[model samples]
Target: MRITVWDLPLRLFHWLLAAAVAGALITINLGVSWIEWHARFGLAVVGLIAFRLVWGVVGSTHSRFASFVPTPSAVASYVRGHWRQPGHNPLGALSVYAMLGLFGFQAVSGLFTTDEIAFSGPLTRAVSSDLVATLSRLHRQTEWWLYLLLGLHVLSIIVYRLRGIKLVGPMIHGRKEVDQTVPQPRGGGVLAFIIAVGIAAAAVWLANGSWIPVPPPAPAPAW
Candidate 1:
């Protein structure tokens, strides 16, 4: 019963990322004028992903990959029966990794995609048209998988809620019921904020095309 489940920063990151992703989906589905917001939301996803990669290394115990990444045998064992752990169980851990990897892929690919018009990725021109087309296709295709993963995630949460577990409340409040004997984790909230803000700023810079300098066109041929 005694277990530290989630760090505050990790919880906030989850909910905020969820909101941003939802906003991006809405804006993209709307069309035209909303592209700017959509692009910005995509950038935020990139930043959050970057921060998460770093956090996975130095974050709180429960927030680190080592804490949840079970071996095949361990996962098999979990699948066969109950884990009953305070932190993420084997299936939950797999979902975590899947979400992180998919989001990371989607965000990175978005940077090379274009609307096939005046609006294009900041670095799209830096790469080849073939690559751009590939990235664009990938960006479009990944949305469906993201939706599937999100649907499963929500369904799992609903199941937990029906079973009398307030999973959403813990995510929002950053607290959960465990044992008094087990100590709560010490987190890097301030550090996490700084990293998130810095990454977001960098994302904005890239999204606004500040990094990719334009090259001069070739000189006209002699008459």
Candidate 2:
């Protein structure tokens, strides 16, 4: 039987977030000139994550955190080969949660980071210098952790493929072929999508420091 395992919004969110993260990583390494683009990509990540967090609550059955969150018993059951579930398994759910949390931290931290030359984060001026320095250091150091997590994510997909499970296809198309019947994903209709998008836009705007009132031209540079 074929079942809908991922909703359209969830599928789009997954791919778009992947592209945004990739762009961020690439532009960050392309030298100081690309810092602005890097920041833009980071903001995109922030927005996407915000969307995901909201969607995880109001999203479809399979996409909701309640559906696949890894509990101790669930993990033990899966480890004992007694658990057969659709969408993410216990270990996969753990990975998903970890990635979401780490990336969220990375994106939020970038909003206060500075290069001490060019490329200051949008929220840098809103925070104290000491806090900015700490976040900046963390932002730089967490890059390796991102790389490690990404590597593990890809490697897990490859391992699953070798074991004859077509994990990637379902993510791309939102459907999976299962031997047994599974409940189709529900909810996350237009209203939920709109709410998620609105929240994401608000997060982007806030992360851009739109609320930080700009000083008025420094009083025309008093002579």
Candidate 3:
């Protein structure tokens, strides 16, 4: 029997976010010419993250934050190989949250990050140079954590595949082959999704400093 584990919105969000993040990283290594594209990718990322956060509150059964939050016993049970579910397992849930949290931090920090040249975050004008400097440094340094998280994610996928557990297929097509009976997700309809997207769009606009006041340009120094 077929059951929906991931929904269309969730799947699209997942893939788009992955592409955006990867693109942003790649563009970072391409120098000044690509910074504009990098900023566009960052905007997409922020919007996606905002959507995901809102959707977590009112999304499909498996996609909700409540669905994947792991308890102590849940972790122990997973470690003991006694945990079974149609959605994310306990260990996987931790990775999901860690990715969301860290990415959220990255998006927020990047709002004030600067390149000390032609590139400046849209919101840089709203913050002090010292604060921007700090965030910029942190942003540069914390990317390694994202790399570590990505490494662990791929490792876990390989580990699961070796164990005869197929996790990736359901994310792509929203159906999984489970021997046990599980309820299909019922939330995340068009209306709820529209609301989530609206929220995300607004967040992106704000992140771009659409409403923030820009400081006046400094006068040119006389030679």
Candidate 4:
């Protein structure tokens, strides 16, 4: 039987987040000229993460956190090869949570970073210098962690493919073929989607430091 395992919003979120993350990584490495783009991508990530977090609550059954949050017993069951059901498995759930958390931290912390040159985060001026320095250091350090996680994520996809499971297709198309009967996904209707979009837009606005009142242009330089 074929079933809808991922809703459209979730699928869009997955791909858009991937693109934003990639853009951030690439632009950041391209030197000062690309820093602005890197910041733009990071802000995009902030919105995407915000949307996903909200969607995880009100999204369709399979996409909800309640559907696949990893429990100790569930992990044990998966390890013992007795775990069976659709959507994220217990072990995969751990990776999902870890990626979300790491990316969220990265995006939020980036709001305070400064290159001490041509680029500065939107929130850099709002925070103390010491705090900005600390966050900047952490941001640089944690970047490697994201790379590690990304590598593992791709590796896992490859491994699953080797085991005759097609993970990417289902995510792209939002459906899967399974032999066992499973309940159809529900929830995440228009109202829930609207709420999610509103939250995400607000996050982008905040991440851009739009709430911070801009200082009036300094009075024309005194002669």
Q: Which candidate tops lDDT? A: 4
Query: Model 3, range 36-152, lDDT digits (tens) per residue?
Result: 998889889999999999999889898898998889999999899888777888988999899999888887898899989889999998988899999999999999999999899
- Per-residue lDDT of model 2, residues 1-223, tens digit only: 8888999999999999999999999999999999999999999999999999999999999889999979999999999988878878999999999999999999999999998999789999899999999999999999999999999999999999999988889999888887787777789899999999999999999999989987666556657
Model 3, global lDDT? 0.90
lDDT of each: 0.79, 0.94, 0.90, 0.94
Ranking by lDDT: 4, 2, 3, 1
**Residue 16 error for model 3, in Å?**
0.4
Q: Kindly list the per-residue Cα lDDT of model 4 for residues 79-186, writing each as its tens digit.
A: 998887888999899999999999999999999998798878999979999999999999999999999999999999999999998999999999888789888999
Better of 2 and 4 by lDDT: 4
* Weakest lDDT window of 10 consecutive positions for candidate 3: 176-185
- Itemize residue pairs with steric clashes in candidate 2: none
Candidate 1 contains a number of clashing pairs equal to 0
For model 1, residues 183-203, the per-residue Cα lDDT tens digits are 567555677667756775676
The clash numbers for all candidates, in the given order, read: 0, 0, 0, 0
Candidate 2 backbone clash number: 0
Show where candidate 1 strays beyond 4 Å: 1-4, 80-82, 187-208, 217-223
**Runs in model 2 with CA error above 4 Å?**
216-223
| Per-candidate TM-score against the hidden true structure | 0.86, 0.96, 0.94, 0.96
